[model samples]
Target: MGEYKPPFTITNKILSYISSISEKIGRITAISNLETKPHLRRNNRIKSIHSSLKIEANSLTLGQVRDVINGKSVLGEQKEIQEVKNAYIAYEHLEEIDPYNIQHLKQFHGIMTRYLVEESGEFRSGEEGVFNGSQCIFMAPPARFVPQLMDELFSWMKESKDDVHPLILSSVFHYEFVFIHPFSDGNGRMARLWHTAILSKWKPIFEYIPIESQIEKFQDEYYRSISECHIAGESTIFIEFMLSQIDKILDDISVQINEKNEYLPEAVQKLLEVMEYDIPYTSNELMERLGLKAKEGFRRNYLHPAMEMKLIQMTIPDKPNSRNQRYLRC
Candidate 1:
């Protein structure tokens, strides 16, 4: 296969982003216990799915996305809910798919667009464009050229995997995927999901970093970056924007982990385990169960942190010092 080279120049801004992201990645991976924290991983996955879908105007709220992920039934538009299910299934198999394989890309698009599109796994057979309220913002390539274009892109990626940093490669792939608008539907979702797959292949920690959440927070800038790159005939701006988002996501996760660990220390976790979800218990009982003689120490370390995190709630908030005051796991 011939090499595929898209028009893009790497600038100082791009290099700076790549360097910052690398440092953040190193810092996050230095946390010895992070990978073992399944709760945090699951939370990040849910956020990733929800924010990516939200960018596409999927109406499911983040809470609703969590419920769906936990297998709890949620009431919503059938199609929107199905989109969530399909996207979840695709993400769940991130390790199984090769990011540089065209077939795997199509398979993921199939999984992501199942039941939502008539041609789930196939490239578009007709015209496609990025549209906004009756205006065509970007027109994709002709449909007939898609198969060749995709093959060349994947071939280039496979060949360049070692030479290119994944931060740049994934971001470039994302822009090119959107630029191609390959599928009849679900192009945006595919772009986001596939980029995550690319990054996860580079470093497994990325599977847990929900960069899409950061993208959703700056949706307008995201679109503008893409459009600017489209007009400029290069993906430099998009790559810069994506790497910035990735860096911000890492910062957010660091803050979240620090806050979570601070609020839920080992002592607080032990206290939580002893308390019932609904049953209220007095401070004396809680302290006694922990074999603690010092009331002030118990409150300072275990009780206060848990309460501040809202994992437990005071039964008598209005009378904190009352003799009858009690607390229950919130």
Candidate 2:
């Protein structure tokens, strides 16, 4: 086996960036401990953003990523878009059941590429190219490397004793795994998913960080950083780039948390918590649960306020007379 050595100059810069971001992430972690519905909403919003970004990055067309971020559905591409959404939903649930195992990886990849690509859940069995500019630069290791590399990665995850921060470890693992490019087609998506799994193991809050969105925001820079570090034989620059994105995303969520704390009504907030586990409620169902005498009273006093605050949304906005008209916690 070749001994791994990182580029010193880029490593130094990355370590510096990690140090700065760690302090900011610490603050976000602290605030997340407050047990409030608005805080929970903020957390869910972050998770939604993260899931959306992961789906967009993996399955959607380049233009689709922009459309999804802009709060628009890909109109003619519903099937493809739904596949991405399903992938995110799968990750959200499956990670909790088994985060690091290969089973989860296969499931994520399957959902990510269901109708979009033929090699959805399988690893690449032949040679693959890594491009730089117009040139094919690095050739991924042969098919034999896939199992060995994956085993080494999981073993390293299990046996590593150094108290290296989870964020740093996750970022490094991401870069290295993608560099290895174990899969034929979905290597990038797998790297991002595994990174989330690694971080979520450390702190559940990280599962909601939307690091991918930040990556998509600086996609060009992200690619450049990875390529530069790869060519220079250092993973540190990639680590630094990831850490900075994590910090920025955490800060963004923190602001939303604080805003929700200040403005949300207490009763409506309580309603939100109750519905977190079970959403999409009808007016009668909500009134019954809230113990209000009149359904109209509940709508005027509770639901409308929540809707106006953008905390809840009507699932059937056009069907006023429909008994099935429901409200969902957004």
Q: Which of the numbered candidates is closest to the native, going by highest TM-score?
A: 1
Q: List the residue pairs that clash in candidate 1.
A: none
Worst 10 contiguous positions by lDDT, candidate 2? 1-10
> How many clashes does the backbone of model 1 have?
0
The sequence of per-residue lDDT tens digits that candidate 2 reaches over residues 110-191 is: 7766766676777777878665435554677788788777766655655552555677777777887777777776667667
lDDT of each: 0.84, 0.64
Q: Which stretches of candidate 1 lie over 4 Å from their true place?
A: 132-135, 259-265, 269-301, 308-330
Candidate 2 residues lying further than 4 Å off, grouped into runs, are 1-22, 33-74, 97-100, 115-117, 130-139, 259-330
Per-candidate clashes come to: 0, 0
State the TM-score for model 1: 0.84
